[model samples]
Target: MVPALDSWQFWAVLSAVFAALTAIFAKVGLENVNSDFATLIRTVVILLVLGAIVAATGQAQALGSISGRTYAFLVLSGLATGASWLCYFRALKLGNAAQVAPVDKLSVVLVAVFGAVFLGERLGPANWLGVALIAVGAVLVAQRM
Candidate 1:
């Protein structure tokens, strides 16, 4: 019998491909569309597609397992995602890819620090070092622009 791939592994692969396509497409597409509008359209399409999948898969029970607090957190996450995407797409439209990409990627470090501070997630020494490097790189990219 074939084994199923882990969910994180599947998403990791999918996200890598999607991220590459997003960068390329955002660069090209923004030439024609307003960047903030483009981000909204993309997010709306994504939510619709994923929502339909959840409905079609009879996953309402899975969603029901989430508590009110978790639901609130998820909604808040979606809101923040929308805001961030709008900013990133605007940057991509107005700035060079080299600088915009690195500065946008700094969200990784921001999220890690937020998780450690608010979500009770622990960042070990190595993770701290990585975050430091990311910060330095982001600062250099922005400064050089």
Candidate 2:
């Protein structure tokens, strides 16, 4: 049986696929451009695509209904995303995508910890173990690959 599209695992796998493509595409694109400019172009594309999505879905009007706190958090998240993209592109420009991508994935472990601490999303032993394994795997993947 096929997994449901709404399942979190399904979405997670989709996200991973796109992320892999992102690394490959960004690496190739960075060869002849400044990382900052590359990031700007990418961000503009994202804005256009997401804007179109929002408009097509009739969610454009929902923006006004969002709370100020939500706006603050989203803006902060956007800034973090921009910073991450800049650093990631710079790293891809300087290092192997194989090495840089895995190291960049260290954010998974950080996310788990932050979620538990800040969001009170408790993780069981299995989840913590998974996070540990990801951290170790990231280190291993970063080694002279």
Candidate 3:
């Protein structure tokens, strides 16, 4: 039986699947277009899709109720996402997606560390082990071949 969809792990795995596809698709698309222009197109598509969802669900109506702190952090997150996309696309344009994607996954390691320090999230031995494996695997995948 499938796990409940509400679980974060399930969602994270789904995200990983899509992220892997994103690299493959972006690599294919980048072959013919300027990476920056491609990024703009992708961003526009995402905005349209998500805007439609928000509108359809009446979620947009709640926008005014968002707290200032939440809004600030979300804005910051959006900026960070944009910057990451820009850099990721540029890197994908120049290198193999397989190599680039693993290197990008290093962000997972950074997140673990940052979450501990900034978010006060506790990371036990298993979490640290997983982080280490990710770091080593990223290096292995990103090696010159």
Best by lDDT: 3
Q: After superposition, how far is residue 9 of candidate 3 from its true place, in Å?
A: 1.6
Query: Per-residue CA lDDT of candidate 1, range 83-145, in tens?
Result: 888888999999876678878888889889899899999989999999999989887977754
In candidate 3, stretches whose alpha carbon ends up further than 4 angstroms from where it belongs are 1-3
Winner by lDDT between candidate 3 and candidate 2:
3
Question: How much does candidate 1 score in TM-score?
Answer: 0.80
Error of 3 at 61 (Å): 3.0
Q: Model 1 — which ten-residue stretch has the worst lDDT?
A: 1-10
lDDT per prediction? 0.85, 0.94, 0.96
Model 2 CA lDDT for position 25: 96
Sorted on TM-score, highest at the top, how do the candidates line up?
Answer: 3, 2, 1
lDDT (tens digit, per residue) of candidate 3 on 71-123: 99999999999999999999999999989999999999999999999999999
* All models, RMSD in angstroms: 2.7, 1.9, 1.7
Worst 10 residues of 2 by lDDT: 1-10
Q: Candidate 1 at residue 103, lDDT?
A: 82
Q: What is the lDDT of residue 116 in candidate 1?
A: 89
